[model samples]
Target: MGVAAAQVVDPGSFKVHHVMFTELRKLVDRIIQIFPKIEAARPRCSSGIKALCSLNSAIDKAKLLLQYCSESSKLYLAITTDAIVSRCHKSKSLLEQGLCQIQSMVPVMLAVEISQIVDDLRAAKFIPDEFDEEAGKVVRELLQRGASASDSMEYAEIKALQTAASRLHITSLTAILIEKRSIKRLLEKVSDSDQQKKKILRYLLYLLRKYANQIIEEQTDDTTDRNEGAFGSNDPNTNFMHAHAFNVESGLENKGYDSHSDKLSIATLPEEFRCPISSRLMYDPVIIASGQTFERIWIQKWLDDGNDTCPKTGMKLAHLSLTQNATMKDMISKWCKKYGITIQDPSMQPDVPHLLETSSISIASFGSYINDLRLPLDISNISLGSLDASYTSDGSRNKNGDGLNLAPEQNSDDLRRDHSSGNASKLDLESLSSLAELDWESQYKMVEDMKNHLESDDLACFSMSSENFIEPLIKFLSTAHDLHDIRALKAGFQLLSTFLNQYRSGIRCLNEDTYSLLSLFLDSEVTKEILDIMEVLSCHRSCRSKIAASGAIISLLNILHSNIIDSRERAIKILRNLSLSTDVCSDLVCLECIPKFVPFLQDTTLARHCIVVLRNLCCNEEARASIAQTPGCIGSVAILLEIGSHEDQEHALDILLSLCSQCVEYCQLVMDESDIFAALFDVSVNGSEKGKASALELLRLLRVTNHDDRQQECFESSNVAPEDANNHAKEKKSHKALFGVKFPIFSKKKK
Candidate 1:
């Protein structure tokens, strides 16, 4: 004031002072208005609002100092202004700190309040209108931002809301508000510097996966219980589901409930928790008409990809509509809450767009693509038998050069008669020629159609003439011997197998040329098909002779040694059928097929077939003697009597009876086993009528043989004459004297 008086207070100085005072007044008024808004936004918790009140008190004290300074003298004004400036700076500092503190706590406080509201909603507990409106507002605000557009702050808010909703078990609302794809997008958007956001996203995903897994488990348990009730506790199918569920539960337990702040990695997530389609945790699951449930986005994308069928079932979609799986969504939410993982808004998910170019690809183009990737053409070049080497040059001559030319005018009756006589039908020849000219793809399709025909229509397959097909089939096999043309060979074998299986007379159609071709295939790589063909061929007496003569039995025996069950079964079946013929049985015996057949009796599935073969072989004395001489043959059959089925035991006992009846030594061999008598007794009492009769008869025969042998031994030992006894004693004394002399001579030689 003294300085102002001395200077005579110029207009510029007065104007500067006025401007300063005006600006200060405006600042104070603005802060006054801001205080109430800050108070209103402050969290309702006592701790949350304490900082805001302190900030308000500081601002009020500064305002009081400013108001008091306007009425004071210049000197006093200067002192009061200093105090006001100090208070204003203090209040400004406090306000900034309070704002940050409040902002930090806002998410937590909102989470708590919203959780309460959600709990109320879930329990159907009374919620005030204001509380309901507030929760709805928060949910709407979080969902307003698209997942791709949302930043870290918005993501945090959405996560808080989702956590609350999930805790309340409001699955439908949670799914609607926070989608899985949106969380993935938010996670992707998080930069390296934003580790907090990344962590939050990861935690939210963990919760999603955990809860999804739990829901799946609960549903699985429910389903298993229901299935157990419906199908009974012994259902094998339900055991698989229970095992899978247990594995998933065990995985979750091993993972434990890690803290949300800890660095949980994606690799830790269980694969079963992931969607089968996307191979990620399911967000919004929907059930398709096929009864399979998948995440909505992926399923929708699959539908949009021009796939008109369910991926799992491959059944045509009756309708593409997805039914919301509310239960799964609830489970995902609860899993997150249990593990302290925060969930983000559903709206933040990214849009999974389909590739437009895929729709333009055609099946024909796809086939061409496969063809381009096929093995090199030169690899298919192999020296196959020439068509002209065996068949007529003009295709008009038969094997004996009997010019069996068929003109186009030949009637169906003539064709039938020729086919019945094992000659190629002209129609079949033309068909085979046409088939040979077709491409590989066409040929494969034809073969598949033929297989289907064989499976579905036995009469049609039998009625179809094999003559035309056989020649072409033989030609096809010879030409397709190259590894590159394996499909053609496979198809040819399949057609041949079907032809032989359906029509017994079809085996006769194999002339010398065809027989040689078929014999060559018996040693080829397609053993399964060839075995099946041979099995059918062995059904006919003439074919069995031809096959045995061609030395195909060796190939069949080789197949029996393979570890493959189907091939072994088929081989045994063929041998069993062929053994019905005495000549074949003798050949089998010479070839040592008995040892191979013996071990198969242990297998329940093959036991019946094996016993049949042995039974047929036993018809011939040489074959029976061969079987009885084989090691473990009698014991293996004895085991079958103990453990085999009713039919098996019957057959096994019959084989044993036949073998033992052949010679007393064989009966003694069977009787020597420790458990043979017990097994026979058990079978006699508990076995089927046929089995019981067989066991009883065998038991009686064994007892009679034993009685006779014992009687003969006793009769010979007790009925010795006195003169013979004296002679025997003299011979014993002479044997002892010779041993005594030899002992000294042998000892002297060793010394």
Candidate 2:
């Protein structure tokens, strides 16, 4: 009979209760037959439905049957379910049974289509309506029965629900507890079990966080509506002070009560997904907002382009991307959905309840982010929001509009280039001897020898086929002690310059760090000869060598600009010579050094050299825009046109033509000045071929000048505009304008 009954019911289509009832009916008859004396001794045999006791007693009876059933039988398991339910109904334990039933049903439904069936059962007429008025009440009351029993009960409940949830493969349930107030209270009651509490807390917190923004937004809207009618017109700010005077009245009068099932829904999820960390729901979701993930290279690029969160996680990072694990993404999604919130993906794809579009900052393409801060530096473990001052490679640390940290680290090479007063001056006789650990006499001797050879023209240049002589001179300088003696330092500088002149490979061999150091020495060395030596070194075989040398000169200029020098006039002369060198001129233009030297241009001795660099930069297509931004660049061009010898006027005109062709904004800067047009016409009519060429170039630039090109040019220039022209220009008409600046004097800002 048992075999036939099992075969007759299709396990796939049959309800668990229907199957249980059928098996129990057959099992009860068998029990009666097998122990007829036992049945007669107790009471008259009744129908299987009437044979069950209280829920606890029925469970005890099921355990008794389990002991006798020796072998696994569908009938035995089925009988246990029937007995438990019947006894639960009989003993007034229906509420607890419903709670247990829902707990089991929800997780299983995640994998199967049991939600409909579970809902029907939930609504079915029971012995009493309010018997299960509260979801966690039964478990809470059962706690007073015994401490261990309560603990065991909660543990088993969490385990059973979690096991079912895993089978259902519904990860979202883990965070629902926080949304249901009753379930939250139930969790609070079981706070002694830290692990269980954490599981509940993690899922609940997840739900709360997901819905937090939406709730706030809704509340804000409601507030605005309430104040609108009272204010006459709907200016929100007008009622702001009085708005808080009114409060939201709480009760069932105006809102639907959070249902018991809703509270249970929250309780049920954490028990479903075994927390990956503890094989239980997470106790505390790791708050990873402050570490290396916050300071990702790719993330920072986004922030610089106006981004405010992780591209993948939608957590606010602002121009900085934090590196995080892929698992976190899945977890966050589940949490968000449970709370009916939308979290945008890094790709800006919508994924959630409201289906709201992400902000522009969040949806920016990877290319755009990278383009914002184009210069590469080592910036690991530094978040845009919580960045450390020491972590940046660029000298200045500033926040972008998105509130992301955008600071570049100071490279060792940069330190060498900007020879500012305080630190360099301190590196004198005592410090040098200590830092290098060599006597001053030996260093002086090497300098003397190098000087004599250079003066007599006896130093042999290294052939292209052999090792570079410039490299050895650099190494010697690194260890040389004569660096302390001003005279010795000058001679060493002279020797280094001579090597630069003799060997083409030397410039390429020197790393950025060495270049910076050389620049620093030039800026700080207390002698004209050393300054002269730097001028010679700044010259190279071709424009490329000169370009590399320009980087070094800029670094030196940056350092020297900060400190007052006794021989500022001589130093200006050397800078002017270096800027005029065609080889390095274009590099200076691209690095934006010309603009930075604008203020110095008015320094009669320095203005001419600054003009030469700008002229060369304007001539080169790659650097024209940078030169155009120079504070006095436009005025300089005008002055060059209005007053100069024929050759000088031609040179100025040549630069003007280059600037107009390559940089529209620069043309606009020139056109904006009233005197500039007249000067261009004057140069065009009265000057040489070069002067006319320049005037024509200016006209072409003005014609091409427009909003579109200006936006594209500045936006595409770099993540960091390393140099600013107004910062280095003459101040007579200096000013700030949209899209950065018009022109400022170097007096307020320097290299």
Each model's Cα RMSD: 37.7, 36.8
Compose the digit string of candidate 2's lDDT tens values, residues 1-751: 0001112122222112322222333332333232222222222334321232221222223222222222112111221333434432322222223222222212221212222222323333212111111222332232223223245644543433333222211123221221333223223323343343333333333223233333334435554465556765344433432332221122112222234334434545443233221232332223244332321222333344455644446666433323454565466457646765442221221121221121111111211211221112222221222122222234553432233332221344434433321232222112222322345565555444544443332112222111333444455565453445556555566766554554333455556545555655654543454455455545533333543554555544564465555345445545555555565565555555665666764555555655665665555666666556546566765675666666666666666666555555555666666556566667768877766776666655554463454445456455444454333332313222321242221112345
Top candidate on TM-score is 1
At residue 20, give the lDDT of candidate 2: 28
Deviation in angstroms for 459 in model 1?
Answer: 6.2
Cα-based lDDT at residue 177, candidate 1: 24
Could you give candidate 1's per-residue lDDT for residues 66-97 as a string of tens digits?
A: 33333222211221233334433443444334
TM values, all candidates: 0.38, 0.30
Global CA lDDT of candidate 1, please?
0.54
